[model samples]
Target: MEYSFRIQLVAIVSLMLVFPNTQGWGEDGHTIVCSIAQARLSNTAAEKVKELLPPGNDLASMCSWADHVKFYLPWSSALHYIDTPDNLCTYQYERDCKDQNGEKGRCVAGAINNYTTQLLNHGTDNSYNLTQALMFLAHFMGDIHQPLHVGFTSDRGGNSINVHWYTRKQNLHHCWDANIIETAEERFYDSNIDEFIDAIQQNITKTWSSQVEGWETCNSNETTCPDIYASEDIKAACQWAYKGVSDGSVLEDDYFLSRLPIVNLRLAQGGVRLAATLNRIFG
Candidate 1:
């Protein structure tokens, strides 16, 4: 389908809301881990890891990894750190330069870089905890793929943009973080767990290389992916102003549908690359 980014986002948001009570695994962190685990299982080496895990509940293993990895790589908590209206003016002028006198510039870049480093350096040695490490790596990689997570200092990744999600009121950041995917699952997938996982796996295998390269290239820069955040902000702002308005909700549905492929693609890339990284390390 020739879907735009906005349409995909709306679908995702809708999917996210449909399964509100599924578990933390439905969250970005868990979803990323699940995607990576599913990707790994698609390969030969992951077969052994698969054997080691319990049967018929790979999703549980992924969620366990998501929880466990939180320890060694505590930096994932930084993902939750948001910029708010109260704090926007405080850090608005901070430049991309290293000398910028505030936490905003450094925090966003540092979080991404740190997460990447943790993924690369992860192993059973150094208290790396293999399953958890792989899961965490998978989750964090997916986190960075979302542009809002690498967002501007002023708005704290769009957290400041107040809006209503259907009947429930929330901000843009939270909406993107959960609402988009939730909504999509409801409208499109209708809570078919196996189908959801299968679809994500297929998408991952198809677009693995490009997605990995995109993140790897961004990580190479000492600065965070400024272009990623900048481009997303423009799209996000347009989404809010034109489509995501309180009464006029054009962007949510259109954006969700458009961005769904990208999200699926990113999950696919994260899963395959994560398995590749593990195979390289453990094999």
Candidate 2:
């Protein structure tokens, strides 16, 4: 509307074109996470979510809304991931939660906290946009679980490291972001995203049943524990994502088969934790 706002929007759109690798998990990954979460939500939280979402849209359908709006909301770009110190394989909110400009609380973990805090105002005298808050909280929960989202600062979380995912050439970040999930969907699920999600859901109920509660619990009555999730992410980044792969490495069957389980686990954790956090918030 305003002339200055229009100029700012154009500038941010330019940045989006220049830095396309800042995204979190791909569309299917996000949808899988949100679908799991929405199914697990308490009645109160689910109804609140329904009220907040746009008409005819569910949480899973809007899970990627945060990613889509980055062009106009430039400040949100940095909030999609954290850049920890190179070779550390550890994440500390104070040290690693800043943006490239070194602004604290600008990373994915902080984004979750900030949005969760905003959503806590639901059913009361609310000021912040709870719809955006819900979408961001749901989205960042998935991002924090993405191992590479809390990856080394030197490589921009593997975005700069070129690699070949099987045959096609792409970056390490893109592999973790979309390629791996897409490949898994195509090869294993007949390219059906819903089938991929159903398989993960089945694992959550049976294979991972005992561990789900532990993943959902937070110490000291916290609504969310992103610090714990971020810590796990960096460790996974070291142990699984960047372990044997070098720049220009070819990620083939061995890499994909081994890493798909970790991806599945992270998606499950992201979904379970998101539902747990929202339940705590809206309960």
Candidate 3:
């Protein structure tokens, strides 16, 4: 029994070391986006999601599958983010949408487009793994909305920038990915993820209602427009995420309070747009 316990503990530690900090939004953020989307899904999309998801699993439950599986599917690592030119704060698909080896169409935006195309072939195509496609689309929609995911190349989307979240040591990327959202929950939502999600959902239908339609709009009959999403993300990355703060800086109440709204808005947009894309594909 003692030997078995040690082996199990070692395995757990090894896994943690391998995936120290998740690239996209932490589990809570992805869950928030997906839960909001599931509620807004059209009947057709809902039914299709039901069919594709494993028994007893819903869309929100599986929204973070891509983040976990990326370790096994090493090819998927680059699909989670796009590293723009350092300090440029601009994104152009042709120039910025490639993997480290210079392979085009390998960035998060391109992954969205590819998966959108694959999911569009549902019911008629057996060549693509539509289950994987659906999950990828759902997840990438959330990823594209995370400003730091479309952040500066040098910092690897803030992952390399050492910062303090209040008094705790943290990387800038992780701060945007999880700390900010977690802090908001503790401070305002009773530390309940569901409440945080509900707050964003309420804003979606009320505060951001006017902008929801535009956020869901795809130009020129396209199924999904990731380029536009990417453009918006980089701008936000510069304006909100990368604005004011530097290496070893401590981000406290002031930073958290101001950026919380941007975080909320992005989560809202991610959910609204995920529902829209699923509707278009499965409608």
Candidate 4:
């Protein structure tokens, strides 16, 4: 009887370990890390973006460009968590420990460094290299815009904070990543990317200069930049934390209303800024 009980116990333990529930692993808000990349190519924008490609015998370039952009989507989203050392993978976590300078140690900053080096290596004949550069520029700009990506060391940017979202057990980190954006996306325009972008661009164009300044100011304190997390109250954070949010809460229906507008304005700034960087590099 004792031997049979031991065998059963071992089997149960193995089963539990193998089939551990992952539903709650990332249930809070979206990380804002990988989601930034998803914003790049909506189903609506794919055809439009393809239309912008150069003509005649450039099939390889076009395909390469598409793949390059797609590749960065995951990185763009993942890079948001780079600043938070605790949230990083074990390998990255150890690497961060070696850097005494806080900013230099940050994953996002490291990604920036890596990206710069990659951008400077001019030997590659990959036709999609330019697109890769542009996509990186766009996605990184958005990543930095999200404050939660620059989270604290203690809580791993709210990853440890147990919370509830509409009766379902959740955490703070996943909430920002999905609930907020998903809510907004569903509530706002008919899930149209171009329209979303147009609306967001129109809304932020007049004040984008100030918005950039605000992000710069928030990021000025290197020690604090990586320690902050988005607030529990998504509506309030959108309203108070960012310059564009006038009301305390953004209605679910109105979420996409501002997304593309914001993306468009950011892209415009990124393109111009990227051009300036290139001019300096090649001048």
TM-score per prediction, in order, is 0.56, 0.92, 0.92, 0.43
Comparison by TM-score, 1 against 3, better one = 3
- Candidate 2 off by > 4 Å: 1-22
Instruction: Give per-residue CA lDDT, model 3, range 90-145, as digits (tens).
Output: 99999999999999999999999999999898878777877778888999999999
Q: Pick the winner on lDDT between candidates 1 and 2.
A: 2
Off by over 4 Å in 4: 1-106, 123-138, 209-283
Candidate 4 overall Cα lDDT vs. reference? 0.37
How should the candidates be ordered by TM-score, best one leading? 3, 2, 1, 4
Per-residue CA lDDT of candidate 4, range 37-145, in tens? Answer: 2233444333333332232312122221212222324433344444334433222344442232444433544444444455555346343243344334333433433
Sorted by lDDT, highest first, which candidate order results? Answer: 3, 2, 1, 4
lDDT of 2 by residue, 14-36 (tens): 55445543467988889989999
- RMSD, model 1, all Cα superposed? 11.0
Q: On residues 122-148, what C-alpha lDDT tens digit does candidate 1 reach at each position? A: 443353333333444445444544445
Give lDDT: candidate 2, residue 5: 42
Task: Kindly report which residue pairs in candidate 2 clash with one another.
Answer: none
lDDT of all predictions: 0.46, 0.88, 0.88, 0.37
